[model samples]
Target: MIPPKGKPLSDFPSLPPGFRFGTSTAAYQIEGAATEDGRGPSIWDEFCARPGTIADGSSGAVAADHYHRYAEDVALLKGLGAHGYRLSVAWPRVQPAGEGTPNPKGLDFYDRLLDALVEAGIEPMVTLYHWDLPQALEERGGWLDRATAERFAEYAGHVAARLGDRVAHWVPVNEPNVTALLGYALTAMAPARGLSFDALPAVHHQLLGHGLTVQSLRASGAASIGTATNHTPVWPASDDPADHEAAAFYDLLWNRLVADPILLGAYPDGFAELMPGPVADDLKIIASPLDFYGANYYNPTAIQAPGKPSAPATATAAGHVEVPSDLPFQFAPMTGHPRTDFGWPVVPEGLYELIMQLRERYPSMPPLYITEQGCAYNTPPDADGVVDDSARVAYYDAHLREVARAIADGADVRAYYAWSLLDNFEWAEGLTQRFGLVWTDYETLRRTPKRSYHWFAELIAAQRA
Candidate 1:
């Protein structure tokens, strides 16, 4: 049964047996030992240091301080009744220079974190790279250079050989599409290059890196390995042919460009011709088989032709910037939808459309898992140190219902990991956006469970009941 909005989760349908529930976090966002334990600077470190780069003029220097207080953080996950935790290993921490000898101290920190998670009965799924490229590598052209891919393979071999015994599930990279577009093309994120389509090389190299990492992980006997790619359904602003044409192109660029190479072993239609270095040979590497496919979904995008005027709308609750006018397509706000605190439209049903489309499009599609899904609500704790975020709770309920509906429709989805477990430093946005079940006090680094946390815990327990 579908649980009505604002009601208890008791009426919600249970996920299938062995369906995993978890929370995800990136290292640079939470682990704030930025300079400790021989950890080198990342591109993020350099990006955050620049004036006027981050929205709040802040950096993740301290973040949630998870590096020193990971045990406390794990307790939060344990209390939430989560079966898994998807976390990223900072590349700069693992290989301070992005090459050469490994950092013993860096590896030791994760060793302790994994031990703690295992003790708490939480499965750890590790993501090798999550946009925090070592600054040393950026100085040598970063992802733009093909050598970075080779270096990434070497680093992956080292990490897999050491942690593969404990970590069965591996994610080679997280959202390379975001890294390429936001960071390189738009300069909206770290390693702010703003090179536009000139950054296409980054896309090819990152995927090559992912493929190489997968091969390295397999060599180390890793069980399940996949990469997380962010996706959103594209909608025309109206039924006009111009809007339709724009949406089609945007869809190819945003969704198909990333998924096609991974799932179908070729670029969308003609995009491969545009990519540099290799047009065919690398496609073989990029199309390596996966145990499961990971997707990060937020909402559908409404696109209009470049010359068409965008619809007048209030700012999004999710704080996504107004779509740039210089783009080939314009973005219009989704009408008649609830908005998250960051001004993002709440469209739980979009998740259903996205996954069903994937099942329809790819014959070789593997079991699906949501690597990241969450809404940012900057709600503060009350005087009693409690955050009552009923909206976030309702958001999860509505979205999970869509997930269940998709599964019933034969999507083969096996797991769902919330975007984050705690409020940490959101890249570029600094710490302003809080997309966490647990409210984190930036000053004290104290974690207080929000109402959503209790709701999710009860839902997880019910799934097992």
Candidate 2:
């Protein structure tokens, strides 16, 4: 259960020394100026242009105006007492066509942002790509083509050459599985293709891109490199054998498929045969050792055999990826847990379970970071201009306790980055979901620090003390 609002930080479990606190934001989701300063269009730009594709028929063309107001956002981060900030570099922005000469103005934007972050004494964790594939690349078959992965390595080299000196940590890709599954197989996100399981090529190419990016960053003098993959504990709907099998498959696809290649240097038996290219050679690159492993967790998922009566009507019925009925598995709602505004189950213990599972599953796993963890609560600023999002405060409180618990059990957890620092464009959901500690007025692009923001600032202060 969520603790009541105003609960003191002293009541929560203590974190170990050097446990960093930070916040994460994606480029397409927050950094607007889609077509500004020679910026080429991304697949999302085209995706949002399609009628009825986005929930609110909204586009991120001017999202939060972060491109113009990053300094203001940096001030908020400093005020929040964040030790580090994780931000993604827009691929199209750096290379408008995802290739050829890098755009000077585009690189200048990040140069200024990183400068501000360093000046404020905050460490910068830069993710090389966050699903904003250049439209030019997508037109050339995107991740489905091996050339795209090669292009990504080139792109990574360009960014590292310019900013490697400033970025303390490098994440090559943000949630590659989600990109392949949602955008390629499910057709629910950008560059929608609805290729179903046939999207396996996209998966292989993305992992290859990640491995290649890691090499590029290292060659450019990147000292710290890691991943930010979304993970969930898959629960079977019932005791039936079919349900158990389906759950195992979903777990393998959602969790192990991306991780085993990186951590174990091998795919879960026989799966490598499905990928294109020289599987053995690519796995060698994909398995490059990392300095740390980042897990982006929200909640546990329940899975059941396809065609079950209890299955959700659509894959995204639970506000996640869409699952076609023809698939071997289906999504089921978890019961008895509080639900976020996005309808994701609030199973804080899932975070603990995932950390421990990672430790046991891959003994050689590097230190872990909770790169993204937060709930969506669209609590508007009440009349006095104060946004009191107590539910979100409680959510963080409960989750942080689990992080502490994992540490007590000997997980080498290093950091916790809230999902975002400000409410911004939410992709297909547009501005419909608010996951930020700072509430954003879309109409005015003004940021108001919510009650949870102050609560977290105090938590960070108390931790440092």
Candidate 3:
């Protein structure tokens, strides 16, 4: 049974000894200063410029200003008692055009951030790419072109060589499935292409790039390497056979399409034939062994066969990507559960189910890391400046308990990183979705730690004790 909401942290099961806890943030989401210090424009920069793309019509130009305020952010992490901090290196910032000479300023910025993290006794996990492709590469066909994968490998090598020694863990890519599905197929994210099923090449190219990146980081003597893939449990809307088939297909596309290549070294049936380039040879590179696997879990999805006349309109109204009428499946709402501000269901047990399913599917899978898991709640400070975000605190409480339950059942879970440390630019949705433990005033640039932050700090202290 799922644990009751808002249970005291002390009531939750103890996490395994040596388990690590941290917070996560992507570069473009937090490190504003889009044009500062030789940082080249990323596809997101162009995507946001287009009218009607972002809900709030805002860009990450000055997003939390982490580029100029790394010291302060580090202190926030330190105060939160985070054992690790997962951050992404902006590719455009490192190699402005996604190729050619490295940017010293970009490397130096991470250099200083790492120094601060090291001084604060926080291990750093650096993700090489988080969907911020340099506009130059997007103009060259981006992930759809195999050449872009080659460019990604080169860029990975440069960043790994520069900061690999300082980073405790390296994640080559963040949510490739989302990158391919939303950005290319659905046109819901940056570099929105709306290519539909033709976007399969982007998926193959991303996996190939991930494989090459693992090789690059290893060559640079990186310590630990993994990936952050968003995973969800696919539930059929009903017991109908058609619904089951549609859910299975959605699962293959959203979960196994990404996992099978990395964990098993072979695409699921029907996928290899659709991919670009030499498939058999590429599988070998795509299946490189990893030190761990990062699972970014939020909520499970309910799917049904297409042709529900109201499905498309209902999903679009709820801020979901519109299900193309031609697609085999459509998303059905998972009713009877609490939802976050972003409209994601609060199903803590889904995390446990996902881990067990993965374990059963891949016997040789690597250790697991709960890489990115948090909710979005608009909890601004009150008159006294206290941010009472009890819902977020309850979200974390329930989710962490689920992780413990998974661990008890012999899942090799290692670490857990909250989705974000500070509220910053949420891509596509813009600044509207706040998923941070600390609230950020976009106008004043001031941060006020919410109630969840204090609760998390206490939970960490209890775990250590």
Candidate 4:
């Protein structure tokens, strides 16, 4: 890994031809006109209202005001010199009830935004959903109900029909595993945070939605289609058989759970039995083929053997994976690595390891992209409107070099987009954390690109040159 110091783009490693560098943001996280332009309230709008749901007691009510300041945001995108911008469609804004006629105003907002992005010299990469389900859908069992899959196709059709003309790259869903685990098994931190063994259906239906959506988009002439998943390496902590078994279980859930279906067109063996329902039919839809794969990687996991007969999951609030408590391999904090403020390990080499595994395993693996890569540092602003967020800058510099290294190693790593363009409403943590290279003055709805912005801009320019 490159040393933890802010490095300019010229100092970074070389990338291949047509390798595009970009930045990403989401609807609910940045566009804060909660009630603007006929947009309906999302599950997050209500979720944040319930006291203690968000750490800062803040909601996306008036986030970065991207709704009104989008022109300025696009200008910032131009200055960053990124070729693409990834953002999500607010399901509520598109279809407030999750199944109905399209919301014209909501649709218009995106039309204008996409046009603005193109005007500013940026290609738009749209993610159909980013965990912000329309509240109406959650009322109808959300992802848990198989109907949600059908509704998602309708929504995808609406998006594709309008923007699909210019928008070629589409991600059906962002982090389906995180949506199922965090929103279901892991304590309902998101909308429909229903923690029941029954939530297994939610996982199946979500993947089904991804598969069906891909089919729908393919039929519509989408040249490229894929989904984003978060992955990490699982290591057995000891030589014991139990720990080995435990590590295998962790790998199945974290890695294969989402990938096997898209690549192999089936679920991992025995995964169906662990799931709640008889998924014979659902598996058919779950294992849909795709043109590419996107992985949102952060850190690796160490697992010991299992104490219990079943392989328990580790989606609880403690950040602990349930392995055999007294077995050979045990989950522990990342060693020999620095941790982020959220206590996530900052291991850039893990990114290299992740890319290599994908290449060696999936023979049909599509071009890999780092969909979301950035860190949260408490970067407070100064009077000059500039955030000297050197920590975040350093974090990104180290990660980007590893990305180039992966490209050099035949990983087919095509693009690297920073997690965000501006600080807005971070889920669970709310506005308490900042992950953007540009600082958002929530009070004024003003955006100031940080030093990392200029550094990355120069880097992108140099890489392209």
Candidate 5:
């Protein structure tokens, strides 16, 4: 059963003055019209076309119809009293072939969206790449090749030159670790390459792309620049030395590999030596200063050395995918904790621990932002026509409390953007997962606010007050 909403603003944790509260959406996840406005096909488009790729046998071809109803979505944001709106400018939308000419029609759509956001008093934060690599670039070696990094810089420059004036916050890339590890190394995500540990080059190239694009965004006179990295705490399954060592290695691979280069201008110990190309030279580019650091936290993961404790992972309300046991470290399920619809344990303290770790690990860590944090739950409308997602409200409240605790402990977190504004097309899981605060009737494409939406709106109003 879903938990009930807690209390009013006075009873909840207080955030600092001018701290941003917003919602996020990715291009391939929310923006439909995949083939319209001369938009070139993306890797996601290709992946979805293949049978058995998306669980629901559905694609983002129509999505929530946000491409045609962005105004309505903007209105939703304004009504929620959002201080910011984090969105991605589809690379293929701007440069259909990933290089060469810019698509005027594609740029026009974002121009209108930005103008509307500004009119609604919402700060627009633009993310350059969000897992939707144009198929043209993928065909030519994708992130594995150095040329893709150069082409990415060119593409960033194109969008920044046009929208840089209005958009203050610029994210060059989002969750490169997820893209390289899942999409390239593992078979879970798009462009399902499944190269396993051999996909190290993709990681380096993505970071290189980020660094190059940071320079491009700067040249375009963008004010605030950052990249969203997916982060989570790694816990050992037991006190055994092998378990601890395996957990440490997994941490180095999952967290430190990409983060160290960006925040500290170096990779985790020997990992850098393994990355392809002139890594020493690339580190200088990868370590470019960021105005802020964006972290997307889900939950902490427990690990054990391979071939130890083969307990079956209990499926949650929505089930979960099993981790490959052949890896150096095996994932052990968190035994006792509330879970979301995605079978992820609801460990809000992990967010606090992650922020504190960043503070302690990197002395030069930029101001932090909870760029993406939210859960997926099947809390559709009830018989009274109300989507009373008290579970989501509790989830937000608990996480915000943790954020407030971190702030009190002197962590410089400045923003929190929920993972999504509306429930549209969830990648891989397809329509099975609903992470939005607003419910969408996919058939009629009608938008309906859930109970969590109102709860969040009230909190935003109280913050301003």
Candidate 6:
């Protein structure tokens, strides 16, 4: 690797062949214009309105304005040499009230998007939902109600009937586990704003919705379908029995909770024993035949075994994993190392180990995709209207090398899509957090790719060469 003028470029390694490279953006994150073109209010729209919901006090009400500037974004995708583009279709935008006849306006937006991908020689990998549940659905109990799952299937069908003609790659639901846990179980950063609820219903219903949607898409002649799940490595704090047991519990909740049921046709041993009620029947639907499995991995959690000389742990500011005081395993916060703007620990090695575990655990699982892996950094602007964003550049450099290392060790990895194409309205944190290659002036929504974008393009050129 060539070192730059004054500083050394990251010493991270390069990628392997047949490993795809792409960029990802969600519907709610980018495609703003909340109430435009007859689009209805998403749960995010309502969430952003609630006091203290978003950090920057801004809503996707008029985000990157991708709805208006998507042409430029697609052109940006082509310029970046993206092999594929992973984007989500807004549930609210497409189905308006989340029921009945589809909204022609919402479908039209995707119609142009898919067309743009085809024209640009980029594969359009679509995510059906990325946490932007229509407010209309929430008004009817959202995922908590089994009817929401049926509605998802119906909505999926409407989408497939239109875009399915050209778009082959499909991810039924992006991080349903997170959608349930964050939206329902933990806190309301999303739809059905609530905390610590009977989320099992939402969980099962979401998975069932995936199965039903996959079936619908499959029937529509769509060739590819999968789901993106977020996983974290749980490390035991010590050898003490308390620590080991606590680590196991955390593992059941964070890592295995979703994959075990879908890939193994059952939850982890202790997990099923802990579930709320008789929802075993839903597993049948959740365990649909997926074409691939996309996992969104960031950092691993250290278990910090109890009753031993406890090692220092890093606390996630996002409060991603909830550890109770009485619980044996407390989140050992990772610190010291340079962190992203979001304060997530910057550890690439965790990603390497994560892939190995997936290989060991679910050998029968489908081909894996690094669904979402990118960091938010303090994206500062330069004099020439550009953001140097070197922190983000390093994050991707290290992570990509880990990705390459995993592929060398025999993981059926197909692709890597950066977390975003452009920074838009970050939920909860709102516009304060920037997790994108392209920087957008919130007011003007002018897209400007940071240094990372150039670095990625150079890497792609080198990868191809």
TM-score of each: 0.96, 0.98, 0.97, 0.91, 0.97, 0.91
Q: List the residue pairs that clash in candidate 2.
A: 315-323
Error of 2 at 274 (Å): 0.7
Best by TM-score: 2
What lDDT does candidate 4 reach at residue 330? Answer: 43
Once superposed on the true structure, which residue ranges of model 3 sit more than 4 Å away at CA?
1-5, 309-319
RMSD of 6: 3.2
Model 5 scores a C-alpha lDDT of 0.88
Give per-residue CA lDDT, model 3, range 98-129, as digits (tens).
Answer: 99989999999999999899999999999988
TM-score quality measure for candidate 5? 0.97
Error of 6 at 226 (Å): 1.0
lDDT values, one for every candidate: 0.87, 0.90, 0.90, 0.77, 0.88, 0.78
Q: Write one digit per residue (lDDT tens) for candidate 1, span 1-465.
A: 223345667778767889999999999999998999999999999999999888898787899999999999999999999999999999999999999999999999999999999999999999999989999999999999999999999999988777777785899989988888778776778798888788889999999999988888887888899878889988998899988999998888778888999999999877888888766989899888899999999888898887766755423212344456677787765788877767778889899999999899886798999999998988798888789887888899999999999998887999999978999898878898999999989988888999899989989999988
lDDT of 1: 0.87
Q: Each candidate's root-mean-square deviation in Å?
A: 2.1, 1.4, 1.8, 3.5, 2.0, 3.2
Better of 4 and 5 by TM-score: 5
lDDT of 2 by residue, 333-357 (tens): 6789878888777888999999999
| Pick by lDDT: 1 or 2, better one | 2
- Per-residue lDDT, model 6, residue 7, is 34
Worst 10 residues of 2 by lDDT: 311-320
Tens-digit lDDT track of model 5 for 1-465? 224675555887778998989999999888899999999999999999999988889988889988999999999999999999999999999999999989999999999999999999999999999989999999999998899999999999889878887897989899988888778887677788988888899999999999999988888787799878998899998999999999998899889999999988888877877888899999999998999999998888888888877446533211244557667887776878888877788888999999999899987899999999999988888897899988899899888889999999999999999978999788888888999999988999999999999999999999888
CA shift at 415, candidate 3, in angstroms? 0.4
